[model samples]
Target: MENEKHHIVPYRVYAIVLLVLVVLTFLSIAITDIELGSYTVVGALLLASIKSSLVLTYFMHLKFDQPYIRIMVGFVLAVFIAVVIVTFFDYSFR
Candidate 1:
């Protein structure tokens, strides 16, 4: 197998990502306090999704990885989303 060159991300970028993740965590916590009724769950889910994407992109080095890796990640994410949707649909009906 051929060795692939990896991109070295700067410490500053990780620091920024950490800061953003902290802020998003706080935002998710604060979101629970708001009186959005049924939308509160949706709001929290949105924030969580953003946080997950940030972790996946930066912390997982997906942002700097090869295109093939990104394609595989996309496929996996699509399957995950589909499963989540089906689970939620089943829950909503019951």
Candidate 2:
């Protein structure tokens, strides 16, 4: 399509995202070492989710994709989240 233009993300953005991912990785290790009671898993998972989202948004180039693609990704994410919640509830209750 001649009307569609290529999306060019700057190297600087990638570098920053990489640095953030590294920091989050270290934080995840720190979370494992700290005595956070029941919150440790939550914190680690939150960081992991953030890191994964960054990777998906930038590395996967989802941010530059069409709205329909983003919607599909959102739908998939919702399903994944629902499954995780159901699994967590089942395990916690048992």
Candidate 3:
């Protein structure tokens, strides 16, 4: 642990990410006004996923973590997505 390197992220990057998050939030809210029916939940969920990823990568400092940590996060996310898809399909077919 003595040789561990520390990373200093610029405030500008955080600001940019925050701005993007806010914009996406508003976009999601605006999307509810449209009557897309079946696709509406999908759109909201897609935006939510993007926002969560940004929060994880930047806010949680996952981007600067070791490769193994990032890979683990990716694996977990993949499993979560698979479960969601399977559940969606199960309900959809019925």
Where is model 3 more than 4 Å wrong at Cα?
none
Whichever of 1 and 2 has more TM-score, that candidate is 2
| Tens-digit lDDT string for candidate 2 (1-94) | 8888899889999999999999999999989999999789889889989999999999999988899999999999999989988988998999
lDDT, residue 50, model 3:
97
Q: List lDDT for all candidates, in order.
A: 0.91, 0.93, 0.96
Q: After superposition, how far is residue 41 of candidate 1 from its true place, in Å?
A: 1.4
Residue-pair clash count for candidate 3: 0
Candidate 2 error regions (>4 Å): 1-3
Question: How much is 76 displaced in model 2, in angstroms?
Answer: 0.8
- What TM-score would you give candidate 3 relative to the actual structure? 0.93
| lDDT score, candidate 1, position 85 | 85
TM-score ranking, high to low: 3, 2, 1
Summarize candidate 3's per-residue lDDT along 25-86 as a digit string, tens digits: 99999999999998999999999999999999999999888899999999999999999999
Instruction: Kindly report the root-mean-square deviation of model 2 from the true structure over all alpha carbons.
Output: 1.2
- Spell out the clash pairs found in candidate 3: none
Could you tell me how far off, in angstroms, the CA of residue 51 lies in candidate 2 after the best superposition? Answer: 0.4
